[model samples]
Target chain A: MTTTNRQVRLAARPAGEPRDTDWQHVEEPVGEPADGEFLVQVMYLSIDPAMRGWMNAGRSYIRPVEIGEVMRAGAVGRVTASRHPGFAVGDHVSGTFGVQEFCLSDGRGVTKVDPAAAPLPTYLGTLGMSGLTAYFGLIDIGRPEPGQTVVVSGAAGAVGSIVGQIAKILGCRVVGIAGGERKCRMVVEEFGFDAAIDYQSEDVRKALREHAPDGVDVYFDNVGGDILDAVLLRLARGARVVICGAVSQYNSTRPQGPANYMSLLVNRASMTGMVVFDYADRYAEGVARLAEWRAEGRLTSLEDVVPGGVAAFPETLMRLFRGANHGKLVLEVAGGKGTGTVIGEGGSR
Target chain B: MTTTNRQVRLAARPAGEPRDTDWQHVEEPVGEPADGEFLVQVMYLSIDPAMRGWMNAGRSYIRPVEIGEVMRAGAVGRVTASRHPGFAVGDHVSGTFGVQEFCLSDGRGVTKVDPAAAPLPTYLGTLGMSGLTAYFGLIDIGRPEPGQTVVVSGAAGAVGSIVGQIAKILGCRVVGIAGGERKCRMVVEEFGFDAAIDYQSEDVRKALREHAPDGVDVYFDNVGGDILDAVLLRLARGARVVICGAVSQYNSTRPQGPANYMSLLVNRASMTGMVVFDYADRYAEGVARLAEWRAEGRLTSLEDVVPGGVAAFPETLMRLFRGANHGKLVLEVAGGKGTGTVIGEGGSR
Candidate 1:
């Protein structure tokens, strides 16, 4: 039997902001699984700002996604056919399954997810890569001690939201910097952040000074550029700045660097950049803890799923760049049948 | 009986390079100790690049040296008159006694030095602040592991010289970047550095690339600016760059920063600045390790002493800025002494 799969392919490299011509939706036949492979029907696809970096043809922590290849992404799906020993036919699996309706996997770096534990879309958010990135970057790289002031940028977004919550769990005074007032409120109310700064309404530097009077001990930087510059000025002595992602500058033609980095000298601070893939061997440990937190009702997972045919992939993913998504943005490819109900405000499934 | 003492005071803050007009020499009658204070006869005065930063009218890791005050410096001296219980007459001690022939101390942050263990100048160099700065900055900040490739800038200077040697002891492949060929040769032969790059004669980037072909794992940066930019381009993943001092930009009217800092993101590395004074509580740990290395004949201490009266303090201290001194530069205040033989190029003591 032949299965039809709609895939998003990279048609051209984007200079600054990605346009319609940059991506192409191609319909292809999904073949049967080979000897050692399994066939998966894609249920939810993770849309991340890191996708912009993968479009560029340069060396980074990870290799860029090649041209004409199904646009690389993380997805949670149900296995339809299995020839692999570890995976069953009805098992829920997540991996680099690309932006497609169906995926064939050889079981390399693929993991099974439980629907009863939480929503299936959450496996792509809180209990997935975004959650693991926040955990290791804050806990291991930042190393925030108890009672230390922890500041997080992009605080309303998926990774930043989890990072702020983890800092709070570590007994730190948590402050967040988000784009709007609504997002700021969500950061404080949902994530248990002590204070929030709306970057659009308030002057970040002034708000930071008022909130973090003793200066920031750990800055979990997700949006680099001017926000990073503002945080640099408010860093306390021996501060650790963890650079997880630079979403604000990822789509810029010319990336703007921090102007006042010399503050690192006066503050005797350190700025470290980390890629979550580097901690791949220990990802299970982070996922286990995050799942436990969710089970205990200590951590709330937010996922915004847009339900439509696979043709809506480009526009759905663009919502993240426009700051339209308040949580982990996921595209639902299989409709509402097998996929669970969407519970959040922006969710439609 | 009245004793005359000579002191060098900061006349004014210099604009770019400090001139002779920036200092004033004054002679005053040395008073006797009060209740607990002791009078120290200054012998060896340390002249460091960090002194330039102290003269600037801005906040730093430490407070700026005040105008019209005695020029600040670390000095090794003998207690000529004592009333303090911790110190006795004829005891050798080291502290921030300034550029003076005598200092009155109540034993705050002052430590006794055994001249018989090593020369009095050795206490100001290998056994004192410079040695401790190198020890902690390399091991604690740089975190060089065994078999890692470690690079050190200003490698022939006081702190950098010791940093390269300590990295060697940790089983790291040590590379030194120095100004002249003579200093480069001395760094390899005396400090046991694996290789030395003549930054003055050769292209810094090319030489660094050749010396550290596999990329630098730990970079102990004493000279920042362009050398830091050169090292940034060749950093390995998870590399640690320790900023101990910025000697290259110390005298600049407007300090220039490294342009290639984006390499930190690409390499997933960290750059941290450190001040040795912050590790004051653990200074004895550094001193003991350095002393043990010296005793085992594995580490050699180099001191270049300029023999003159306290009136020559201004000119003697300028040798550091000019890079005229090959090793730890110290001023020997002339007074009642035995044969004042200026020994050149000998082992420790």
Candidate 2:
């Protein structure tokens, strides 16, 4: 067995957009699993826009990553060794394994995954944390009833795509707000959105008013900023705005403050911020439902897999912030073979 | 039968603080009740700060009072002549009867009050709409759990006083924010509040920090502005901020916006604006419970009745905004037999 493991570590916190100088790549001999711990070689790593927020030095739903720590991320891997009773060698698992070649886990929050149920990378995308986030945020927090108009920003991305589709399944009139015509069309045609607004070419507020003539009942906001302000103007009475992420403001040199929040008062609406980790107790329910939808072909699982080893960690993660990935942006660390590739079996890898 | 009746009509919209020119006093003959309508002789009129919001020319929870309309107000009056099946002559009733000596109602949302259960004026205070507003705003919207720290602004006034006491009944550590030490002390002693902050004399943020070191779990806000901004900074995780009214901003010539609303994001809190009219259907449950508490001496029925007939209406109503009212501010409109007496009876009416 190979003794060395490559990992990406945060060298310093960035002021705005993270630079390569902010990260340090290091290789160390892989250590054996201790009692009640298991060792897994990471197969895929999840790159989320929220990772930028986790790098900031401030109080949030979760603690920010400290300097010199392995950059925190979610990963799917194959357990190579186990000293814990709950896991064994050859078992497929997923957890917050960080941006590393191998991870050591005590099974605190890690769970076993079945490749036969979905693609291995889907555990990091549509069937994983992203999927669960959209599921709980839209269904529970946003609480859109049938015939209600549901608007989703960042609608082409992993979380937003699932959110819009779920609203569609609930018999809502779903609208997607994305950057360009191509992405907007994909969301409406492929994801079953009723309408799509090309935010790059249209005035968001005007476009929203046209698409949602009755005003927006639920706004699943993944990219907050001016778009959020635009949506605020068109909110129906008793509208619910679910704040899943604020990707548009993540790279701002100064804090991006919302300008038109008083609309919440005029419309008697509410804005609620949510983190999926808060619903950890009910994650199985979300996972089971998402998995069933994918199996029934009602939900499409999309993953933009960047084929590269641990060296591509930093670059692969940036694709999410750049809007370079149409689907879930994940880094293929170890070989895709035997790591679980059921959903990606007939697709180009 | 009275040969003439007096009424106060909105003469003009005020630019800022209302003046004498904004209202016009007119005399007219009392008309007979139409079919399905009843004639009510106004007795005790409720002068709430919310009246200021109604005068504004914009869409709100309720429609704006037009220029020529009689000034809208809630009044507890006696039915003089009844043609409506639901009501009869001599019945004590409460409705949006407008500010006049005589009012006509068609039995829409009017409730008959029992003078035996409580005095007619009490029907305009603790056991009426004010009581229901405090009950639902605290329990339904704020959702204060036992052992949680609950805070309320406008603490000495009608709704705030009831809110603090209701929180106490729910086993919460209640804090009140009022303008002066007198009202603060009254809130603590009369309403069972654990502490009270004289926001005008002391720093609200500092006081809240010291009083609720664990942070505020629920904030029932009647006053919004700097006090609201202060409370925003001290919210506990998953805290609920109930925006029942923004009395502080009602008279501002320029709109006052909350500067620290981002605290909602940092604390994962929620701020919900609500109007009592939304819960009109469930008002009976609230009134029933409030009356029961007053009967058992568990809840203090506080009323600050300003005597002098209908001529003093404008001046008496101003007392609410000036913090001159120790509890509910109801006008003694006709020199009734029970003038200047605080009705201690407990029940509806």
Candidate 3:
């Protein structure tokens, strides 16, 4: 068992995009599990757009990570020691374990998973927070009906890729909006989207006109800015806009709103915001369904795991802003090898 | 009977805030009604912020008024000649009669109202589109429950005054936001709002924090700009924002989007757009309920009627943008005696 735990802590808030200097790496003696507490060796840490929001200080859906605190992250880890009845040694578990080599927890929000059933990294991607978010945001807020055109922003990313698949499974025509041609191609071929819009090269509104000629019925938005404005213009009557994340605006000093939001009035549509924590009670149902689809060869998850473990968290997180990494970006702390799946890099599965 | 009909036609589309050069006055011969047609002598024209939207050349809920065409308007008039089964001479009717003294109609979108039961101007105010807009937008879209806090921008305007009253009738506490001290006082005293915020003088966000300590449950927005942003930041969990109109943005070449719209996600709230015309089938239901409330003295309609015939329409319409009108703005083409109601000055009934 490891006696030293390496952790990443926030040194300062970023003005725009996060920089390496804003975080500090720390080495600490591994914490021992007290009575009713369990110790975990974190295998992988989830890198998400939400982490940027967590770094900010203000009113948010969740509390901001205080300066000098371990930067918040969702991770899948194995129990190294157990003093709690709910957790045991060798059991794979998922929780808000921060960017650390090990975590000591008392079983609050910690859920057990079977690594034999799915890959350790898959538990942090398709079967973890991303799956639950896409499930609830799409099914509850998006409410896409069969034959509806469902457009997803951040189409090559974690939650968005799964959102498109689930939308297709529900009999929707899925169109994904991504940064480049390669990611767009992977969104179509690997994620099973009907069409993909390369927002970098093409005009989103004109592209939407060709792909979704009838207008978008359900728009699951992750990156908010001009793209959100573009989708607002082509919304079908009584359309639903699910505000999932604003990754594009998260780094902007002046966040751009959907300028054409009046289209909601013109189309009699609705824009609703969704937060995954609101669906905590239904996580089991979401996991069961997602797991079932995966086991049946209907759902697929891709993990872009980076090396360097905990200390590399700050740099790997910046990749999301630069659109450098694809699929569910995760840092493999315990894998000790180049083990992330490469599915979204053009024609590759 | 008048042989000549004075008309105001659109000469050019306004770049911003509509200048006098954008319109042209014309004297045309009164046409005789043919088979299945009727003639209407327009009495009062409804002056609304929506008029500004109709001048813009783009896709909207309704088509823009074409240049050289008589500017579109909702008017209450008395039928003079009728060759149709649904209409008779001297019958009071309401329709989009334009800024003209005479209207030749085939009775497609016209509805008859009793001028004897109410005043001629009331049909264009509380009993017309203004009343129906307030009814449906408040009840159907806002959906305020008992004891909930309802915030309304443009609180002293036609639709807003009635919206506050309807929200009050639904057993909710209402806070109104309007420009100027007199308008603010009128919103509280005449409109019976629980509180009023003068956006011209007071800080809207700080005022909201004081007035709506528990946060706003329903926000009926008319003047959407910084005020919408302010209210957005104070929304309670599961709040609903009914976008009735963006009077502030209608005149701008570059309309401002609500920068704080992401607050919808933090509160798990929704922002929905409401167009009064969508509730056309339910107009009778809305009017009936509004009339009942007025009859019971629980509701009051204020008409900021301007004296001067149809030729004064261009100038009279500007009153809405200037916030010069206290109540429902009406361009009186035939009310030669300056008989418009005097309310909403301050501390008046």
Candidate 4:
């Protein structure tokens, strides 16, 4: 193994859509793990749309990653070396390991995952931050009841795909809104969603009215802007709108607000914003439940793993904004193997 | 007394602000009470900002008034004749008495008010729907805590005035946002708000930073639009934003969405919409508490009773949008006397 580590660092905050020039690809010598610390070889890097928001210099749920710092990201990796009692060599762990081939951690926020229970990349997708976000934001905040109509935007993405499945598990009639026909098909046919609205092709408002005839009881919004306003107009009385992520607005110079927010008043609804980190204390509960659901064939975990080294990090992350990736967009490191690209088995899980 | 009932009916739906052509002034013979109904002589008409919303053609908390229908309003009146066993001829009562000299009710939604406990106009202001709206919205939705900063827009209006005083009673550091220096002074000095933001002359965002240095824990938003966006930027972690009214955007062809709503995600806050009618079952609870506060001199009730009786309904209601009314804008019928125009006494109550 090479003793050199490669890292993607934030070079400059982009005005709009981030470009390759906005990142710095650099190399550094791998450092040894100190006491109570572990060295991780990042195997599968979770490329999320929130990465765009983190690059901006402003207040967010978490502090903005400072300029020149290694680009922050969530990743699943194997412990290469460990001085911490909690981790051992070959132990699979997931954490905010950033965009790098090698990571040094104190094992503070890192949690061990069993590679046998689910695929390694699944840890970065349905069984990790994405899953937890959907679990809490939907069940806890959205408060979806049985027989209720639940609509989700960006429904084929990491968080939203899982959100739709969870809503189905809870006996809700799931309707997904995706950018393309392929994603919409995958969500409905493969992910057990009752209906799909191709926001790019179909009129989302009209489609929602047809599919959700009783009106949408809960809206799990990943894409904000016009999609959010459209969902706002279709909300049922006393509905709950879970503001999970605004992927549609993150790349824009100005994030569009939901002009139809008065629908909240007309329907006596609520819009609440949530961050997955807030449920850290209950992550184990979420992971266990998701694992059981996957075992029961009731949950679909889809991951779109791009086969490229860490050098392709910048371009790979841009696929989220371009609507090119169908599921969880992940960057598989060069040396990483057995990172499970299990497709069409047990319904795209 | 003249048996002619003069009414202001809706002639047409206005494109933006209601014009004189939109109202149809007509006269009719006063109808008598039926077996279970009571005939009321409307003494104090409550002209509210919500009147603008009611004129709009769409789904709201209540049905929109059709063209040629009597303009709906809440008013305090005396029971001139009662066929209902629950009410007496001399009793003072309040209900959806509409914009007219006389009203007939079956005693279903009407509630008896005490002119001796507080003045007749006081029932239309602090002891009526305005007070109940502020009470439930602020207490239940905003959930302000002691020592927390509670910021309210439309701070000198009917609902906003009560919201600020109630926040103070709950030990919250209250900040009111109003137009012009006169109303700002009234909110801070007369209504006992800790500070006031004069939105006309100052930058709301910059003013918020100075007045609510600790960040706004609860935002009681009555005037939604740019002001709501500004407050969204200043929200504290886990803040609660109460969507009371959007008087500022009532006349706009398209309501402006809050561009800074992502602050909700960053702060893990919630914005909820509430209608006072939702708490109709608990009106007694709110009324008892507000009445107690008024008796204790902790709550201030301000009313700007515009003369010219029911004929001034349209023009008096316009004062709310123009920011001309300092407190609760009301219309006193010509025959109505002893309604108590106690200006600046007991701190604008």
Assess each prediction's global lDDT (C-alpha) against the native: 0.85, 0.84, 0.89, 0.88
Cα TM-score per model: 0.86, 0.84, 0.95, 0.96
| Candidate 3 segments exceeding 4 Å error | A336-349, B336-349
Error of 3 at B243 (Å): 0.8
Best by lDDT: 3
lDDT tens digits, residues A244-325, model 1? 8888887887666665566787799999988888889999899999988888888888988888856787788778777888
Question: Model 4 reaches what TM-score against the true structure?
Answer: 0.96
Instruction: Give the per-residue lDDT of model 4 (tens digit) for A1-349.
Output: 4578899999999999998889999999987789888788888899998899999997788889888999999988878777888888777888999888889999888989888888888998989888999999999899999999999999999999999999999999999999888999999999999999999899988998899988999999998999999999999999999998898888899779999988888889999999999998899899889989999999988889897778899999888988898888889873345334211112210
Where model 2 places Cα greater than 4 Å from the true spot, the runs are: A1-6, A11-29, A56-59, A80-91, A114-118, A229-239, A249-271, A306-325, A332-349, B1-30, B79-91, B114-119, B232-238, B251-271, B306-325, B335-349
User: What TM-score does candidate 3 get on C-alpha atoms?
Assistant: 0.95
Chain B alone: TM-score in each candidate?
0.95, 0.94, 0.95, 0.95
Order of quality (lDDT): 3, 4, 1, 2
Is 2 or 4 the stronger prediction by TM-score? 4
Residue range with the least summed lDDT across 10 consecutive positions in model 3 chain A: A340-349
Interface RMSD of 2: 3.1
Q: Is the docking of candidate 2 incorrect, acceptable, medium or high quality?
A: acceptable
Docking quality (DockQ) for each candidate: 0.36, 0.24, 0.68, 0.73
Per-chain TM-score of chain A in candidate 1 equals 0.95
Q: On a 0 to 100 scale, what is the lDDT of residue A245 in model 3?
A: 91
* Residue pairs in collision within model 3: none
B310-336: candidate 1 lDDT, tens digit per residue: 787778767777777777888887422
